[model samples]
Target: MGFFQRFFKKVEEVNNQEAAASELESELYVESPEEEAMNLWVEIAQNILVNSVRATGNSVDRAFVLVEMREQPSFDIFYQKDGDLVMWYELEDPAIKERIENELLPQAPSVASAVNGNFAEIGQPEITFAQLQFEWATKAWFSHIIREDDAHAKLAKDEVLHNWFNNLSTEIKTQQLDSDTKLSWYP
Candidate 1:
């Protein structure tokens, strides 16, 4: 091949390689912001359930499995079956406590009674990322509970829940940070 033709071919190959590399990098690094938020939500849900269960001095009814809600942020529901009553509890934003009390409770007295009577209520439960996996499984129960039907509302609520869970999880994890490890290793 002629020198100029060979040189041009090599340059074109190099450009193609660079373009492929850029596309691969973008694919590897690009993640949906919603997905990241959902992950944070999962961590938070696990923590709250753990802390709440611990505070109550009762282990989760392991006979039941954790299920995530579809079309929602990181929230899960647990259920146990009895002769005539099916018990259900959802782990979600702690702020749902207020909503449950003010809105849902009055409308769904049975659900309210189940929540108030059977489950122990712990305010502002704190948990660590490591501890999270031990409490709740990664799979969540999918469902729509009213406002979730609206796309905009669901997105807004999911975002809010994600932020709330992230903040709380970070705070709890930070508190558990090993200050002694740094000092002792350095010393």
Candidate 2:
């Protein structure tokens, strides 16, 4: 090969390497909108769940709830019932505290009254997640009895817990990071 041909080829290679390095540097500095949104969502969701758990503060079954954030910016809470793990519900609303206050707070009075054998309001009551579970389970059991829903009559608690868990598992398994570890650890 001639000196000119060799020199031209080396020049071309150097130019290509410089262009590639510059492109990589630009990519490193710039973030796509989707990535930014996802990062924000994760931060918000983690804060809510951690804060909620902290708010519970050493109650019975305090750590029973596990919250996971999905792509739709929704939170799924896993309820640990009698050693069986299941997702009790999904919180899709953007205002996490308001949603919890509205939905969970109301049940406290009713559940307390029911358990206390008066079925009457006892002034203002602060309901924890455990009380909420009691309300949910009792309501589910009675609903089945009232409707004579034999499909879930004998094992209402198990049925309710398992059905929701299975459904959530199917959806979450597909999207969740380290889902296999979650399934094994939680189950």
Candidate 3:
């Protein structure tokens, strides 16, 4: 098996596993608060992506769906077919951004939110980021020579966190979803 072959196979396996899990969940279904929020987030996220693509006239397969962590977590769609970013989601509208951000506030806090404290001031997200960093660093995914305290003396969170983000990007590569679209998270 070559790289692409193995990659697709793994994706198919994951899809199968998810399908099995979903079936099991449906059989034993009980809608909890967490599950309810997750369902809502999934709907909003999908709507944003679909609407953005429709507005831009770009195909999802030829674009990158980025969940940016530097701000209120929202979809950052980018068209990647023409080498340059030909299509970008216009999220500069404050009303639109806020509506999405407010709805997603507690529902979809990401790794970057935890690392940079962008999503919440102080919470479990931060703890999650710390644990994630410790695991990845212990595994030697990237060098953690710089201390977090030292990096925090300057702005933009920490250099060490940035390094971790870059390392994670390398680790995850560009994940191809079942919809044949590329997706990744960034700090």
TM-score of each: 0.24, 0.29, 0.34
Taking the tens digit of each residue's C-alpha lDDT, what string does model 1 give over 92-182?
Answer: 3445444433533233233222222222232212111111222222233221122223343333433533443444333334332222211
| C-alpha lDDT score of every prediction, in listed order | 0.31, 0.33, 0.36
Ten-residue stretch with the least lDDT total in model 1? 178-187
* Cα deviation of 133, candidate 3, in Å: 23
Please rank every candidate by TM-score, starting with the best. Answer: 3, 2, 1
- Model 2 Cα displacement at 100 (Å)? 4.7
lDDT of 3 at 99: 45
Off by over 4 Å in 2: 1-28, 58-78, 81-162, 166-180, 184-187
lDDT of 2 by residue, 1-187 (tens): 2334445555666587844433433333334444443333333334444444433331212122222111111223454333344433332333644644555434434433332222113332211111011112222110111111223223333344455456544544343332222222222
TM-score of 3: 0.34
Candidate that would win on TM-score: 3
Which candidate has the top score in lDDT?
Answer: 3
lDDT of 3: 0.36
